[model samples]
Target: MARELMKGNEAVAEAAVRAGVAAYFGYPITPQTELLEYMSRRMPELGRAFVQAESELAAVNMVYGAACTGQRVMSSSSSPGVSLMMEGVSYIAGTELPMVLVDVMRGGPGLGNIAPAQGDYNQIVHGGGHGDYHSIVLAPANVQEAVDFMALAFDLAEKYRSVTVVLMDGMLGQMMEPCELPAMLPMKTEFPDWAVTGAKGRERRFLTSINLNPTQQEITNLRMLNRWAQVEANEIRYREYFMEDAKYAVVAYGSAGRISLSAVRTARAEGIKVGLLRPITLSPFPREAIYQASRKLDGMLVVEMSSGQMLDDVLAATRFTVPTEFCARIGGVVPYPDEVLDSIRNLVKGPLTTEGHPRDRWLKRMAERN
Candidate 1:
């Protein structure tokens, strides 16, 4: 199909259909309600299953059931709604089911605002429910990337038999951009050997998350950890810009990354050697990349919509070797390019104390913001 203007949420829905998603079960929530609305109309026309589930909890459970049948199933919601589905998501992960979940994140501590925020980073990437588990988290910087990642999400889920999450902010879901839509992928009707289809001319098989045997549970835990290690080794992805001979680097992901790119360019224009590192996957984070980049850079800046959740990972990546600073706009507000530019300027040119730390200088700049 020719490139056409599409809302980010609509593009995600279209891409899922093109990626051969067989079933969709979702409850409407702000900034992402259009995603479910799009699927509701399109899935039926494509002869696929679509359910406007009674609630977020029920929606995720429906996805879990469909995933067990070896079908490409999906569910989506915003922050608060996603919270309700965490228990179901944890169960799906425990069962080693392949499923795609989209989180068009909004600000939240409780029923917050229907505005963009990356506050869900810790909850989604680090496992919100009770278990030692990790979801393959994809953070797209634009609508096109979000569309492209939909196919990748399903591919990675099926390949590893793991849950994959596409993380987007509320703005990315509501904004419109020109997108080159992916072609339709052929649907699969045959079930996998591990799928829990009824026994027919074969021995009985069981699929359960309850491993009552302590030793067996340990073995399962080790297997999952090993699988995650492989994912970390092979699935980590990131994009870098203007790193050669840079004095400082800025790290951001998703919508924040897109905004920071503009700030990077602005900083460069003002004679600051600022570079950007955009992480595509949050789980298998680009640690090695950051480590290598930190060796040459004088300092690092972490920009986010949240109160520096991803910054912890950035600090760990650099081994706290370089002076790092953070800037954020919380409570559903997005940082302007000028605001990020100011942060970069402070990191690059602001006065450092006797200890040569940027904290005093960065704090002074932050205080000026008020």
Candidate 2:
């Protein structure tokens, strides 16, 4: 495929069309407004359904309704907008409808700002919606990955009959980069009998998130858990950069991983042994990869745009067996390559000691700043 320079959001919208997404219902929110805008124009041109919903809640519910007909459906939003869509997301999950959501995240606690940040880590990965459910979360570091993962997101959602989220920060969404768009995927041929598409001369079908019967709901929850376990076993994805012979490592994802890769390259050139472990799948995190990588490293640094979200996963992956350090930027601030390089230098400067938890070190740093 020919490479084209494109903004991440635009690439995602186009990718969805080529991936055969039948409908897109979304409300505009920055850093991802371009996604909805692109879909609005292109989906209409492609003869696909498109709706500029009045609110995120309405948008997600529309996704729910479209998905019930077994159509490839999607929605996009930033942090606060995603929060508004949580109730609908819960319903979608409970009902076991397959759909894709793109989160071009911005700084947040509450309408924080229109800047890149990984503030929605917990909300999206750890069941933002209620009940025991998981979303297949893919965090793409660049425009190409964003385009590629947008297609993968739909495939996985259908394969698992669950929500799949492409979690990109605002930086990736707004930045223009060269991307090689993938070939168009064929529309899904196997439609479930449960899909509600006109029951003329056939039995009626119904899909509902509500399960008033306690025992039946428990059974449903158990089934969801089993499916999640299957996803974890088969769907973990990540990239290891210069891990061989490295004594120090930095673990990051999304745009932060992109920046950390540069820091690792710089550190390596300076005779400081550094590598990067970038997780592509955020929900079924590459825990085994982190563990194996930590085995050879003297220390690890987790860089993030938020205070420390994926940092927890890195720590979990390391089992606190390796010394881990954290460097973060929040409220629209992004840590530069120099800042990551400094953190790498600081982490490897001292003697390696596997002492108390990494959180203590993070807290000590916070205390010093305060």
Candidate 3:
């Protein structure tokens, strides 16, 4: 297939279509509205289901309903909008339904802005909904990755019978890049045994998240926990650059990781032994890889578009044995490669220590700079 220049959001929509997504239900939200817009036109042309629901809540519930039928269903929303869908997300997870969700993160703890940010790391990666559930979260750093992960999201969701999220920032959502979308997949003719399809001549199947009995709920929770263990064992993914002989490294994900690559390259050019580690799966984070790298490195730098959210994970992964520094551009501000490069330079020059929290030190640095 020929690679064509495509906007990130539109490419993801087309990718999902090619992946045999049977239904799409979403509300218009910036940085991701193009995804819904594309689906609105394309889904109808392909005879698939598409609905621009009245709100995010309605949209997620529609996805939940479609997922119960064992169909490939999805919804896309930005930060504030996704927040509105939390209850439905929890419901879908508790019922052990498979569904895909794309979260094109924008600035926020609230309706902050339509600019790119990684503020939703904790929300999406840590299961924003109220429940003992886990979402298989994939963080893609570019348009190509965003497109590719759409199909993978569905596969993983079905494989684990759980929610899967394609987590990218607004930058990746709105940016354009050359990518080759996957070939169109034929929709499934056979439904899973657990599907809530009509009980025509067979046993009536029922699917619900509600478990009134405490013992039953505990069993369900244990089932989910065991499934999650399988995910952790089989699915941790990450990419490394210039790390074979490096003394220092930068750990990031999504857009921040993409930008950090440039810094890592520049640092190498200056004869500084620095590398990069970008996590592909944020939920089943590549803890072992980071821990292994920490054993050989003098220090690590974490870069993000949020206030040290992923940083917490990195610190725990390394057991705080190696000194770690942080650089962040929060509230819609995207940090430039030079900023990360500076952080790398500091990491090399530091009397690095693991005594205090990396965020606290980063906060002190931020105050000093301002």
Considering every candidate listed, which one attains the maximal lDDT?
3
Q: What lDDT does the true structure give each of the candidates?
A: 0.90, 0.91, 0.95
Count of backbone clashes, every candidate in sequence: 0, 0, 0
What does candidate 3's lDDT look like per residue over 1-370, in tens digits?
Answer: 9998999999999999999999999999998999999999999999999999999999999999999999999999999999999999999999999999999999988899999999999999998999889999999999999888988999899999989999988999999999999998999898899999899899999999999999999999999999999999999989999999999999999999999999999999999999999999999999999999999999999999999999999999999899999999999999999999999999999989989888998899999999
Candidates, ranked, TM-score: 3, 2, 1
lDDT of 3 at 228: 97
TM-score of 3: 0.99
Tens-digit lDDT string for candidate 2 (60-138): 9999999999989999999999999999999999999998999999998897999999999999989898888999999
- For model 1, residues 109-133, the per-residue Cα lDDT tens digits are 7999999999999999889878878
- Residue 143 error, candidate 1, Å: 0.1
- Candidate 1 Cα lDDT to native: 0.90
Worst lDDT 10-window in candidate 1: 352-361
Q: How far out, in Å, is residue 364 in model 2? A: 4.5
| Colliding residue pairs in candidate 2 | none
Q: Show model 1 residue runs off by greater than 4 Å.
A: 352-368
lDDT of 3 at 269: 98
